[model samples]
Target: MMTDGLDGVVAASTILSDVDGAAGRLVIRGRSLDELAGRTSVEEATALLFDGFFDDRPSGGEWRAHLGQARHAVFAEVAALDERLIRHGPLEAVRALVARLADGEDLATALRLVAAPAVFLPSYLRLRAGHAPVAPDASLGHAADVMRMLRGQPASSVEAAALETYLVTVCDHGLNASTFAARVVASTQAGLTSAVLAGLGALKGPLHGGAPGPVLTMLNDIGEAGDARAWLEAALARGERLMGFGHRIYRVRDPRADALKRALATLGVEAGRLAQAEQVEAAALAVLKDHKPGRRLETNVEFYTAVLLDALGFPADSLTCVFAMGRSVGWLAHAREQATSGRLIRPQSRYVGPAS
Candidate 1:
């Protein structure tokens, strides 16, 4: 028997992370999402995730220093960012710059691949907006430095911590599509940069990393909490799929969504906006249940992701790039894991075409 989208297929065994979709839980390197999201820094989480995967991986304290160095190293490629590349936008522009990186499976290579988006994203965004790119401050933490570079000023401790929560929460999650794509490339011995590029290509798809922007659009269209039900009902009547309300794997509320909602609450975003979003979420869940009685649909990460990142002042267009920055660590770690122990990911497909 064959399955569409290879549903329920077990591709590779990993010691990295596990996604228990049935329970709506995510565990990374033996720690639950809740334990890490609000407490761990991105550098610390990366250190945890990278342990045993790389020879001579940095300790938690050393991880920050190494990541800062990686950011500085990746900044050299920013000179390649010209008008033509800027026109392609942040994601494509960062992709192009990342392509320039030398392919390798070593610790240095991993750091650079992880750092590429942090350095390249802000540089591209700034250059596109007619501002000079800011240099990396190796003394600062990874999330803080990215915010600092993006705004040409330091991010408040609260802002930095909120971004850290997002980064840690999404750092890795089982064999997600992009992580699987990274693993497949790694299995081919294509090196870390190539694997990450593969993952980025996969994530560029709308069905995956592209939904957060649309969530913001939905919120904008609805305008107010009182208007949410009518707006959602009309959209559903027209057969429109509600953005950020469903997931392929999870049958319950996404834990990451709750994590981000908490983070958004701390950001002190416009009281009305957050309240309206909460009302909209409640309204969306109730409406979705009424419309699709047999299906499980609840708010997923993208819903709160839109609100939180928007509150952080990142434009919706650049949201996916921001996601890439958080997820790149997972890609590198998965690529390294595959290269270390896994084989080429060649799956057999049943013939469905008309017989010759």
Candidate 2:
């Protein structure tokens, strides 16, 4: 028997991360999610992911310099992309532009793919907002340079650390939709660029990485603390799904949700909005319990993800692009893993209709 969405189907073996849906646990490279998110930087997580894979892997001071150089190397490409491509949104433009980088399965290609968004996103967003793009500072850390490029100034320690938490928290999960897409592309012997482009395309879907934007929209609509329950009730009455409250996998609270909430609390910006979200979360959880008694619809990562990104001054629409920045590391990691299998990812499909 086949599952409709390939549910519960074990595709391939991986040493990267594991998603224990029953326990609501995410373990990356043998470390718990909580231990990695707030404490580890994205650069550190990248090193963890590429530990046994890449031959030219840099560690300690060398890794930071290598990554910083890669970011600086991509500046011209970000600036040279056509202005018209922004019509498809920065994320789509990012997908198209990544294809312009050299194709390979080597460490250099992996580093460049990882660095593309850190350079491309801020540059693209600034240019789209009618400002001149800022160049990357090769001396700064990954999250710090992203913020620097965005604001044309150094980020506060709090802001930079929050962004680092966000990036590391999302650096890799289980074989999520986008990662799976990347792996499938890689299985076909396609280059890293093609695999990453496939991942970006998959991530663009609303069911996947697009919900964070609407979580903010929902918060905006509710407006006040006392209004959350009533607003949520009316929404549920209209059969509208709450944006951040449910997940397809986790039967308990999403582990990343707490990690991100903690990250936002660390930043301590936009206290009023954060309080409002907390109230909204409590109200939504209570209401959902009363409404869908049998279902486990708890807060997921995107709930606090929205709050933190908003606190950092990112527009809601750009949340997905920001997500891509962190997740790009995971995509490339999975792509490289799949490419090593030496077996194409060809699964048999059963025809349900007339066999002509």
Give every collision pair in model 2: none
Query: TM-score per candidate, in order?
Result: 0.98, 0.97
lDDT tens digits, residue span 1-356, model 1: 67889889888999999888889999999999999989999888888888888777766678889999999999999999999999887789999999999999889999998899989999988898899999999989999999999999999999999988998888998888999999999999989999999989988888889889999999999995448999999999999999989998899989999999888888875566789889999999999999999999988988999889988888888888889999999998888888888889998888889999
What is the C-alpha lDDT profile of model 2 across 1-356, one tens digit per residue? 78888899988899999999889999999999988987998888888888877777876668888888889887878756566787777787787778789889988888888999888888878888888889899899999999999988999999999999999999888878999999999999888999989888888887999989999999999994458889999999999999999898999999999999888888765777878889999999999999999999999989999999989878888898889889999988888888886478898898889878
What's the CA error at residue 124 for candidate 2, in Å? Answer: 1.3
lDDT at 288, model 1: 94
- Lowest summed lDDT across 10 adjacent residues in model 1 is found at 264-273
lDDT of all predictions, in order shown?
0.90, 0.88
Tell me model 2's lDDT, rounded to 2 decimals: 0.88
lDDT of 2 at 38: 77
The residue-level lDDT of candidate 2 at 243 comes to 93
Supply the TM-score for candidate 1. 0.98
